[model samples]
Target: MRTALSMTLSSFGANRVDFASRIHEALSRVQRGDIDVVLSDLSLSHPFDGLRLLEELKTRNLLKQSAVFMIVTAEANAQTVLSAAELAPDDYLLKPFSGETLRQRLVKAVAKKQAFKVVDQAILQHDYLRALAECNARIEERDPYVIDFMRLKARLSLLTGAFLEARQTYEQVLRIRPAPWARMGLGKSLFRLKDYPNARRVFESVLAENPYAMEAYDGLAGCLEAQEDLLSAQEVLSRAAARSPAIIQRQRQLGELAQRNADWPVAVDAFRNTIEYARYSFQHDAGDYAQLSQSLLASGETQSAEQTLAQVRRAFHTPQSDLLAHVMEYGIASARGDAVRAGKSLQAAREQFAELKDNLPGTYSVALAEACYRAGDEQAGKEVVSSLLRNQHDDVAVLRKVEQMFVAVGRESEGKALIEDHANDVVELNNAAVRMAQAGDLEGAVHHFLSALAERPGSMPVALNAISAVLAYVGQHGWHDAYMQLAQDLLARVGAQDPTNGKYQKMMQAYRMVRQQFGIKGA
Candidate 1:
């Protein structure tokens, strides 16, 4: 009852009009700061309609603990109600409704928002652990909309790498309502846990509900990709892109699929669109320019390819930016039928890399090897690849690159033999570590992992799992200080190298648990 009075007072203090003006200003302010509520007329202008506004807000962010967004419509109908419900506004009211409905909605919204206030703030600040804790606290609150609360918390858990907690919340949400998002969340958790079949099943269920759900399609494609089903992954990306042409990410996904299959033209087009969309947003990436240049060269548009390379070299002046610049310049020189110039340029690149002196992994060596081979120095190219293999002996991608370099230099048999030797070494070393782990000699297993890493520091799987096993063993040791030190080191290494490695993430989660249990700093 006093809300109108409070609104009037607040409006005077803030130099606003009436309650409606205050609400409008508040809703507009949502983008600037975290809005706790929204009040708008359902029947507004084209893009300013209440439903459209709510949809935009939902897509930008889900609900926060203290976010109490509502819709006030002129008239309620099946269509309007369904739309509002689908967006899951905190409260919905028919226009010409009494103050009672507004008050009721406000009170309910405020209560729900307060319940989630801590979590919302934490998540907004990217403190996912706090969000998960808050959500877990409200998992069984006596509210009809607790399911939404639980789902929100589960999402935070997933972001925080609390996969087990996220999986539990997802299951709970599914039991209450088979929401497509919840199903997708479960699939995502299963994927994180490496349960591909279950993840595929969950993604399929999401598709059954909404066949054009791009997220589900992407997730399904990821499942296929993990299983090495490139054809199926390509098909999935193709279908998703066809279904949602407006999704720039889907286009980029298709581009990646095309590039993986060596479809240069498709890759170029898709990456071009991706770069276009990225120019104005947070998705912008310098690598896109380099990739576009590579694709252009692959398509035999040598002049256009050189132009693309020039753009990247001129536009980005950072240290690592020169890597792609050098790579593309070498390619362009070789394409122009000037092996002599190409050789000189590649030699300069090699000298530059040597001056840097192992600051990065053997990436420069591999790239340079390819350039030298293309420039007709077959023996020099072979030596370059051999040096790289010596540094990163167990990295499959690096090994593949080396093999390609050898084949380009007319040394296919040498390349095959080299790869086979490394493969045999990896298999034996990995098998020994596995046996050590199974035999409960975790300390010995950890030593083996360290040794394997010394042998091939760039092997993502071997290095990541090695760190994971160490963290897991540390968790069992009750050595909180040692655990924290090792955990932070692993996190730094992962951040430096393969940040996307799932096992590295598992170690991160284990680290978090140890930190939480021991009340360690940076938890």
Candidate 2:
């Protein structure tokens, strides 16, 4: 698939094509935004395949944007094609084709992609309204690719937060063919509308017919999580990760869920695999190393835990990773009754974080807080939790972590009070902003929303509402670079919180529109 395709493309005046031999290298390039188009094959070295690569791209939402991806399979197996629908590849080329056929297919794919530049550009700028209009215009003109435009319209509606319209569009597509991607889109819309029971059934049916669908597993897991069936959620993720170990994101979640279940053995293995697999991708997080060492300590393997900590210190050298390693070492020493070392490490972290209030990522801050609490500086730990809560008042995961950290320090009452008070404060702030907007004081509304965001950076609801007000003001007034940047920062924070958030898709659309209005590139 590599050497031969290169030769074929070269025959057609292709200037350059990187033939990647390692899965990790190719995935790293994709994550780094180095590849604008990807042509992959079904089979590869063990534990790696084109589908897994496509799954990662889809999860990152790269497939829908500027990049063009095509998968070459040896045979057009019904299930393989059906499962591949989830990623919505540009085109699939069956094997045993002549050079002319391959050339023609490539030519057609490239042409369609070029023609899609306008729609793609608008989406890149987050102007889903413009994108939707362009798509409708194309459809009304009865373009030969009208079916394709219909699918694009549905996706645009979904991105625009037009849930009902998205649902209708999906249904319209499904009538022509029962594609898993379309059906899954319907399920997603249902999930967004909070119709869990129906969403669950649709996801189940998707997996039933196309068991290899990665998004189906994610959707089913979402359904389980919403129901608060942590055990089932863990099992669902466990099964999915087992089949697709290359999915390091799922592996990380499995580790978290395992810890919550007190399944230390599973947590240890999951963290270990996450650390190992992350070495192969550009998606490394120092937080996983901490999780591994802590899980080892939880399982009563102090020596092994310390060894793991030493390895982490050697493997990653970023400031955050350094802090993470120190925290883990302190955690290990505290577990072993080495008070002196624990206290020293706690002081080191405190000194590093002394000047900055909201400098570190939430996960890193929480890790430091845990280590500090264990090292006997309960106040420092509580303060970190307070900072995190102020930003992410509605993040259930952060809230749970806050509860756990505070309860460990014998400050459960204070933690609960802090949570309630800050959550209500954010709500009041947003309510006041809404009132301002209603009273035709859009500028005041934007001001209060910005202040609310300053107090609580991780609140997606607040960020979304703030973004709405800013975009409205921009539409009525004019584009200001300051407001655009504020909206951009909030979107970045939202992404830092959870890129997979359903609302995240909608917010990015608005963010693009703001950037477009400001005549700015998305970079």
Candidate 3:
């Protein structure tokens, strides 16, 4: 394929063509020089494939608007094809194509890339509204890539939180042609709007047409889970995992679902796969070890559970991991009726938690709370759960997990009451700030949220509200350097927490607008 591509490019009077047989070599070459075109095969010998290469290029911001990326792959499987398409390659060429065919495809792909240059620029700047407008204008021009622009418009609408517009755009595209991507986009829009039944139907329809559509399976599973059909969701995810076991998020989702269903063996296997698949990926986490150990203990495998904790201690030599290891040890010891060992493990865990509580990830709180309760430290347990609730007041999933933890410890009613209390507190605090802002007290509102953030340091809602208030102040009162810095810092924290969050993306767009309005050089 490489030889053919080189010959084709040479035939087209291209001055230079570079080739790399491995993912690392390709990445290194791209990093070291300016490359105008990249043609990669779907199946690479390394665990990282062509899709991963494309991902790395985007992550490193190496793929310029003028440069084209085309996938040259013989693999015709739906999983590979859809995955490649999702990354939005310039074009995909199947094997056994002629030199002339390659030239034609390359020319067309380059033209498309050139046409979308402005739209790409807007997107890279996090200006989705501008990009959406560009896409809309292009669609009105009846260009050759009208469908592509329509697709982009739908995607940008989703990013901008215009779910109804996204749904409408996707449906319009589907009316023209039943593209799988369009169908998936429509399902996503419906999901965002909380129309789970219709979303489930759309995803199911996609799977019926293309059984290997892994994303369709995921969407269907999510809809099922949203409708509280855990068994069906588990079944759907299990089928998807059987077909493609390399996706870490899918494996992790399956593990959590199975754990929720009390299918400890399935949870163990899924989490084991998640750990293995994520070993070299950024998705790897110490929480996976904790989850695997919990599943193992639930399945009456205390020795294996202990071994997993030991692995966590070795793999991650951080305070958080040490705390996690000790917490798991306490569980294992308690399970084996070793009261003395359990007490010692609990004491060590408490020491580590004392040092790390202010900045701990909320994921570890449940286990720590459970351990505290088992050790007869009800005050400590309540404190941990309360802090978690304060930080994650609006996260339904985390709240559900907290409720489950409470149920496991036989304090379900207390959990419910505590959750309600914390939720109300956060809501009332947020409302007070909103009222202050509405009463022409933007500065007061900003200060209010900042104080709330001090009390709930890891609270995403609080941080986002603080950012909003700060930006509003800056927008109305001119750019206050301190206020702008506060907004940026809060944004950084929110991005570190979850970059894909729609609210974070919106705040980023707003921040950029503010900077641009003020002639800020660094925006």
Q: Tell me each candidate's TM-score.
A: 0.62, 0.81, 0.86
User: Quick one: ranking by TM-score, best first?
Assistant: 3, 2, 1
- The residue-by-residue lDDT of candidate 1 on 161-215, one tens digit each, is 6688879888887787766667778888998888999999888877776664556
RMSD of 2: 4.6
Model 2 off-target regions past 4 Å? 22-37, 43-48, 55-67, 73-84, 93-101, 111-115, 139-143, 156-164, 373-378, 394-397, 400-416, 433-523
lDDT order of candidates, top first = 3, 2, 1
Q: Model 1 — TM-score against the truth?
A: 0.62
Task: Give lDDT for model 1.
Answer: 0.65
lDDT of 2 by residue, 1-523 (tens): 5678789878977777776655667766665654657887774223456776776665555454546777776744634544535457777777777779877877778777765676766664455666788988988898877767887788667655688988888888789887678888888888877788888899889888776776777778878877878899888888777656766778888898888788999999999888887776656777888888888988999999988988888888877777777788788888999989987887777777664546666788878887767666767876877777776667676787777667756778977887888888877887898899889999999888878777765567878888888888987798777887777777787766555455666677766766677687754
How far does residue 510 in candidate 2 sit from its true spot (Å)? Answer: 9.0
Clashing pairs in 2: 125-512, 126-512, 126-513, 391-456
Candidate 3 local lDDT, 214-288, one digit each (tens): 678888999998898998999999998887776778889999999889999899999999898777665668889
The top-ranked prediction according to TM-score is 3
For each predicted model, how many residue pairs clash, with residues at least 3 apart or on different chains? 3, 4, 0
